[model samples]
Target: MKTLLESMAHGCARCMYCDDSRGTDIDHFQPLKLAPLRAFTWDNHLLACSFCNSNLKRDQYPVDAAGDCLLVDPTVDDPADHLYLLLRCGEYDSYSKKGEHTIRVFGLNRPDLVRGRRDAFCLACSKPRDWHNLRQAGDAEAGRLAQALFDSPFVDVVHAMHRLDPRRAEFVVGTHTLPALEHWQSVYGG
Candidate 1:
């Protein structure tokens, strides 16, 4: 079960919530305490880091006034629809109550996570250039670099870069890196 959950996770089995640390816990998306009947349900399981599973979100589920769960379920919900990442600073801005709740419950804006995301943003910006150069030079390591880029922590940053509009992406990632990013997106379908 753990192996299956890990396989389902993104970027070397990174935590589904934080996306910065290895997923070490089988998180009950709907906590077992809150929904004991769903204890053994397959869809309830999510890969999470210790900090996110134990320290942060442990059994704490919030609901809207209408009794809808406020947390963003990564399996069923697209987080990008609710939370937007600021490419410049690695901070997340929530456009919905669910996003706001998830950010608070998961500590998405914690100092360490923010720093990690910022660093990852820089790496995501630079890796495309490196990959392009390596490919042009016919370097054997180009494939490895491409794989590493996909497997790196904070893969959300990479995907966000790809999702940026033409002018904004070019402005943020720079002209040279934008084409490479687009090439990677075309090839890798991120």
Candidate 2:
């Protein structure tokens, strides 16, 4: 139990499904009802929000027509391959079928989640520019901002916006000079 809690602490505490809410439940990535044999397996366990776990997801584990999982596994697949956030509208746009299915099943684009994500994005985008204006600030203040940015919810939204930067020469996040996003990589990484 201590080990499990430690892993959650060292990583993003946000729900894996919505990435907006607190991870209040340790969910079976493959539901126990559907795959009982794997109930106690660590790889099968994922931290999730109560809303995504008890409300939206319930026991549903969507599969493709051929019976393969349609949901993006945060531990395996890159979520960017499946889903990208529409920062302007605060909705997730699908780049793959898995993304569409995951969104439908977990209600990732629900109004409440969208609002939260939008707020996260706006602040993540604007705060860096603000910091740029206050260029004379010391490392101590910058450190505080970095801590706050990582502590903020729905940080993936910031990553999504960074991915779409006009000056993004590489497809990776290495170049986007958004303040405090470096803190995000240090914590819960993509």
Question: TM-score: which candidate is best?
Answer: 1
lDDT tens digits, residues 76-127, model 1? 8999999999887998989899999999999999999899989998898888
Residue-level lDDT for 146 in candidate 2:
55
Kindly list the per-residue Cα lDDT of model 2 for residues 1-190, writing each as its tens digit.
Answer: 4347436642357777787777888888898888899887777888888889998888888897799999998878999999988876688989999999888999988999889887886687666554444444544565566566666788776677556644541333234444444433344443
Query: In model 1, where do residues sit more than 4 Å from their true spots?
Result: 138-140
The lDDT of model 1 is 0.89
* Model 2 misplacement above 4 A: 2-6, 9-12, 134-136, 167-190
